[model samples]
Target: MQTMLTTLILGATIAAAAPLTARSLVSDAAGQTYDYIVVGCGVSGLVVSSRLSENEDVTVLCLEAGALDHYEDDILVPYYIGLQPDGFYEWGIYTVPQTQLDGESRHIPMGKGVGGGSLINGMVWNRGNQESFNAWNDVGNSGWGWNALLPYFEKSETYTPKNYSGAEVQPELQNPSVHGTSGPVQVSYPNYYWPQTNNWFEALHELGIPTSAEPNEGLSAGGYFLPLDIDPINQTRSDARRSYYDPIIARTNFNVQDNSQVTRVLFDTSDNLTATGVEFATGASAPRQTVYARREVILAAGAIHSPQLLELSGIGQSSILEPLGITVLQNLPGVGNNLQDHGMIHLNYNYTSPVLADVNDFAINATFNDESAAEYYGSKTGPWTAKPSCAVAFPSLEQVTESASSMLAAASSAAYNLPSTYDDEPTLQAGYERQMASVLSELANENIPAFENLNNNAGGLDLALMRPLSRGTTHITSTDPFTTPSVDPRWLVHSFDYDVMILAMQVNQRILNTDAIKYLGPSYEYIPQDATAEELGQILLSGIGTEYHYSCTTAMLPLDLGGVVNEVLMVYGTNNLRVVDTGIFPMVPGSHLQAVAYGVAEKAADIIKAAQ
Candidate 1:
């Protein structure tokens, strides 16, 4: 019966296909000069452009490498997250082979279209721990701590209470005061949750991890139902395009160039470091053109591409550009030096008894059968409205391991002797020292969650190292902007990181052994149940992957500490050039990047407005 309903509604909906409005092309742009020219229409680009274009006198032009969204069912539906990667909307980039992970290279999935990663990422909306932001302020970046950034976080989202037909919404699960009600992005919980989630939460409770009243209130060191960027009214994905750009695209002063790739920032002269405009190409084999930025040229191309653009524009480390025969415009060594990402390991388990429902059945792998589709199309409810995983737990070292103090001591010792490359330059040395101190502090404090556990409904658990000490680099190997940069995340190079991951895995085993979880009947385990920590370490090293939260490539710090941008997000040497993306993060926060990206762009808009 369910299958029949879903199929009929899907067929009817497909037959009534609506025409998508074509966005303004670059050729249609009337003027050559604009008050602000924003590159990359991702989360940051859209927010910055939307807010800047509010002033009717100022013109804001946004250039996106990918075309406008088709609003395809796969992209709009909340459950079809994992399917969007490597599709037409993806950038199709991959990381270089990671030597620590046994020479394995993982795909670096980034959204290519106007919405950027917000269009394709798993819609988990996490604000991360408060201490993570405080660490930024501690490192010379004032006005960036938790208290300073809370307003921006609240300003970006319009929080809606969870309401579904069959499932009872838990009032204690959410705190309304910390969320916004009039923001652009819509955030809410699903109406329906898998029955197995109850058992999972029970297991967490049995293990002494309390349920947080409001994790977004800056303290997320407990179990919680993760909020998603989905609209409760329409039951669709609330991406950057839908929230920020689509509403303002019709403004006369706001213009967008789709399917356009920016090659480099055009400088006034080879000797001078002034950014006048940018050179770009539209579509494949199109003629290159230059457009002037009357006031500023903002790079919101994201962490990977932002740094890549800087290098191609001759503003990166001299050693990298000089070797490529590109003239050194500004020798900023920090452009791509501090690349960091959340390394994750998935642990799969098999159930002995038939489970109530798996995410594959209704979420990511739903066949769109008649019943489910009918329910969704008719009432905007059911499993189609939810993502694969909704429940997440943030566990600190003390909660997961018995030797938290010993581990902290080891990390403190390791901090003093970081890789020699960190000390090769005074700037790099200072940055490393600050970052190491922060890492050690988090490791010692039981209040801070060192790792995250995502309860994937398919009986698989995703364990991620939230605050990793391992740092890597992303640099251009050639002068051509078309060539992909060499990205080495250097996963698990530090011994302390390996220790923490092994301990996290042990915590997973403990959760599995709980009566509430064990009743589900564990028939299989990815790693043997009796495996020792050493064996688990080996298994983790071979299978570790990224949480896709790439950040901190071009950090905001004091210039003496290898900072590429100031607190205002302007590039260190260039006056009219600024970056608005995760690349400006001083370090990777413990949460997903999308939430922070939106907040950063919101704050950036105010900064630019104040300057004007």
Candidate 2:
């Protein structure tokens, strides 16, 4: 960790940024007014703020509760993946006990520092699916369709084609014409890919899944190779800080303060609710400081904390706020009502025969790690550079489930429209009515996917439910800003969600029977042979996990439909304030969200600039 930090520090020293001491930070934070004050210096925060600062006349200030990550090995190295240590870099919080999973609570590790989730995520660069963004337009967000959002997606990434030119295997990838040549985030394929990927792709084909679709065009309902957010030149993680913030840190108009947690969004309550600035503090006991925003105050604190900030400032449900002795400035119940997450379950398989150059070799044999490290340092080629699973297939419901007609019939039925376990609030129910219709349309369409089957290649397959019907809530538990909010994803609460999980396991069994997969001699480690649907449902609910892609906490829809913000991303009933994060995403777009985050921030930057 120390060695990696030293190298990053040296790189920063060599960059064009002015001396760190010369930059305006907490010392210069108090009593200042900027055109834009962005809360949370995460992926979207840094992106939109930096882009706004491009005009020399505009001033942008970014505040982050956590300090900058020193670029430790666990963060920079792809081998470390999701195993970054707890505390400093992650907001490692646990959700409230899920009622359907026998009251079992789950852990959610969200990025906490300057670069945000882009700093700590698995770096899988996926552009979601075409229907996912088009659904946004259906939910009253005009001009948010695929054709409209595609340019921003391209504008956020600089793609390096993986169509190789050597004796090595060349994996099919996104077309160069569909991507940006000069974007802030660098995305490219790793030097090493699992040799068994082609075999797995063949197995998926044998199961009637196609592998020819280009994923980055928002049309990834089939198998395709995914790129990582790594610099093609250096082989290190390319996050928002490095890509968007570092290069523009020297801009005199832009300044970011670390360790400054905004406690509340300050507003003038005389006749009309209007954002003035925010009240923040360096620590819970530290003296509070107030900074004003001349133009607008934007929330980019992600799905978990963004709504918490809104409620802390009195913008959430009055029933929730009034009980906690907090005055309600706006009774917007939708501030934290539409919380959603991509639910996932993993099935581990054991290889009867050894798979050479496997990702698990490092753990199975100590000497193998040394050799991998040597290879990585020598030529930037090794298993250490590969993600746990880069080859994934998104199969539609008809392709994975046997009783597709009955399931679709049930989905279209009134019984599945408003399940008892889902929210009982009329507005939330109405909002779900719109969202459920969109999901059902996608499930019925053979071109859209119901789940993502990601072969870890070593021994596991991650089955992630792409569009879950279950909607939950994330609300402030107390008036205090330091208190952790209540996050309840309500996994498997809906009948459709349960059916998808159970059916996906059966699809796993079918995958093992394929000729290409049978060649690997794989055997399930967790699943019992010939288990009943009820028993299998129990196992799935017991071990269900979440993709780090938590979103839709504060949705963007019509105000009558319990949406927190408007089509323009501005919070309803408030002036000169907006939300620009995953919370504003009407639904979890496809499964992966990092690439979509880049696009959302890029588009939001333009929206905010145009309003200016």
Candidate 3:
């Protein structure tokens, strides 16, 4: 029932209790100093420590290994975001081996502590696809196009939308001048949505697909009920610690250490990485300390701890820090290479009359906007802000050009440049290790489930093979900045991320046998229409996963392509470091990568405050 209302709003017998508040580092218990340190309060370290503490003399620390959230229910519901996988704010990261499927091992769940992965995601806000930032300004990433990041996604948004149904405006496909009405992140649209899935919007206007009232504008292929960063006047889950830390937690020059952790980054003595300081350690404590920042360090520890804290402070690659002895200070080799992620395939169905069930009692999460779902209850809006996949279908890869996208983007960019040796290595040429012993040699491959019928029936088609040219690699076996390395998001290991996860599970088994969702009430389960295409390619090489949206591990290209932050995100060899997170993207944007990582940390805090 929405997993027992998310195990009764995460009191599931104190789900491993403890966190009541002890993450103090709010500064000066004798250790005060900072112009910025920001390690991992997630969502690129709390929006670059709330925009570099708006320079009230600039002092910001923010470490966070994970705690001090309190707003539980596995992160404020929204269909229990797949029941908070590995709970306790997930860091259960799993990846590594996979010649392709049979080698299995791939759970990859990221977002440990503070607002990282926007507090364990699934809030689904998408603002991507302005041709993925005009293909990152067509590869080079200048001012990141899409009209230079559409006013930083309307200055990190604050929309609202909950007048309870009645206001169904199309105004040319939902364009309220493309959104953003006050900012500080509120976004809206969900109050409950179910009306027998609004007959798939008249089967998506009888499959012509044009019904936008603003699906975050910038063309989202087709299929739309979009908008859901959440808040719709208190319906919760507006993450980034409630859209950028509760509208600036009383600001006094922001400190925020919480459960601490930082570990390395200390330098000085003409090694030149100045303003020295940082060594944390609190949660599960054992007496560890240090905290100095006087000027700048910003890493936003994401996309796998920002390239394992820039190869544990020596700054990356001397063939990966001379055999882990360490000390290689910036050879860069793309500190953790071009990781990239977005590989789905979860086509579950089995509706007879619960039309894709909406369990969770207390009368569906406390009156999911009452008035008996009044077009969405008492004037808020309708179909309760419909999320569960509320219309989304971005096709193209010439509908899986044989087995999928130029046979697995030449074998996952040669398993991501054969481990950053880099000279254009990317050429794994889709054998998907061996295409899983040729899953039924080619059981009627069927062009994207005959162009999205998504296993025909009562709505349920999740075919999302966005940008998966198969690239993956986030190295660092050891140097121990805090050690978690070896992130290998080599998902679908390649073969166009295993033919775009078996062409989005063969277009959710051709929309369960379409005719506009086969007389509404479709039926397919997990994935078994009597198996074989070698058992749906070993249940999609082994259930294709990770949409935490990782990204090019600190990439910000140009240094002969193995870039590690340059176009003003600094880092190439340090001098004040800086990274801001989704680890400097450099590519991966089909959408929903947290409003483009808050418009690339709000244009990297205006190029680090116009270079100080």
Tens digits of per-residue lDDT, candidate 2, 79-168, equal 778666676478879999977787889988888889998878888988777888899998899989899898998899888876544312
lDDT of each: 0.81, 0.80, 0.61
Writing each residue's lDDT as its tens digit, candidate 3 over 521-607 gives: 555566676565667887666666666688877777666656677777777655787787877776676656787787677777777
Name the runs in model 2 displaced over 4 angstroms: 1-26, 164-173, 414-425
lDDT of 1 by residue, 1-612 (tens): 235545455534422223335455446543388889999999999999999999999999999888887778777777566755446598788888877777889877888888988888889898888899999999998999989998999999999876333322253457787889899999887656777777777888889877675678877586777788988777778899888977775788888888888989988765456788888887447777888888899999988999999999989888779988999888888888888889998788755556555664553334543445666777777766666567778888877667989998887677343333355578877887788788788667777888888887556877999898888888899776777888888878877888888888888888889998788776455678777988888889888988888888899999898899999989988877999899999889888889999998999999998888
Q: Report each candidate's C-alpha RMSD, comma-separated, in the order given.
A: 2.9, 3.3, 19.4
Candidate 3: 10-residue stretch with minimal lDDT: 447-456
Q: TM-score of each candidate?
A: 0.94, 0.94, 0.36
RMSD of 2: 3.3
Order of quality (TM-score): 1, 2, 3
Q: Native-vs-model 2 lDDT?
A: 0.80
